[model samples]
Target: MPATTSLQSLHVMVWTALMASLIAVGSFLSIPLGPVPFSMQPLFIMLAGFLLGWPHGMIAVLLFVAAGSIGLPVFAGGKSGLAVLFGPTGGYLIGFVLAAGAIGLLTQARKTARTPSQTPSWALGLLAGLLGLALLYACGLLNLVRVLDIGWNKALTIGFLPFILQDLVKLVMAVATWRIMHGRGLLPR
Candidate 1:
């Protein structure tokens, strides 16, 4: 590869690792609420998508999950191993990849539409983040029903309902962070 391409690859690898670490750290800051805990994981996941775009963001999330599945204490409450991947909350864990991809794709689309002088819009960013969260919830709810042997109503109550408001807050925070980073030229265009 050319030197510039090689350097870019190195940059992406480093950011991917950093994002994975952020996800792991986010998992540690959790409030246990039955099977699916409330955590900062979604924030980092959204940030990864916003900053890294789809491919790299998805890679970062998958790496985080792989690390956790391999017995690294990188999951919520420091739980780990393959068992966790197959556990009740596993679907949500897996959903991180999809969520990041969705957010990244949306951001990328917006980015492509803008001129070099124009900045990303906060409303669009928030919409992308909310869509990502919705995808996560969909996966989580389906998995909750299957893993817990619960009905849709119970799954909605246990996994989705309580998280709506908090997730909206997270969505806003993610968008704000993205706006700040982009405004400061901390994020690549």
Candidate 2:
């Protein structure tokens, strides 16, 4: 390859590494709010999507999952491997990629559609993030239902109800972080 191509490849690799490391570090910063811990993963997930945009953000999240699957201590409590990926929380783990992509696409649209005052309010951004979070839970709850042989209502009650408050906090945190990063010019517009 040409030197320019090599450099571009290096840049891509570096961003990939940064995204994976951020997710892993975010996983460690948790509060153990319930059966599901309150973690900074959502914040980083949104950050990944917004800063890196859809394609790179998705790639980054996928790389993080792959690392965890290969048995790196990239998850909460330093756990990893295929079993953890297949565990109850596994679907949520896998859902992060989609969540990031969705958020990026939606956020980009919101930004393009309105002026600052007309743009989505902070609440709206938080709500959007929550929707992304819900996507993660939807996958998780469905997987739980399938694996645990439970009905949707019961599975949602058991697998999702408890996490609502924590996820709300996460959504708020992610939105706040997005604003902060935008202000600092750390995140792209």
Off by over 4 Å in 1: none
Q: Give, for candidate 1, the lowest lDDT window spanning 10 residues.
A: 180-189
Residue-level lDDT of model 1, residues 111-145, one tens digit each, is 87887556689888988888898889888888889
Note the Cα lDDT for every prediction shown.
0.88, 0.74
Separate clash counts for every candidate = 0, 0
Q: What stretches of model 2 exceed 4 Å from their correct place?
A: 1-16, 30-38, 111-124
- Tell how far residue 45 is off in model 2, in angstroms: 1.8
Each prediction's Cα RMSD? 1.5, 3.9
Candidate number with greatest TM-score: 1
TM-score of each: 0.94, 0.78
Error of 2 at 143 (Å): 0.7
Which residue pairs in model 2 clash with each other?
Answer: none
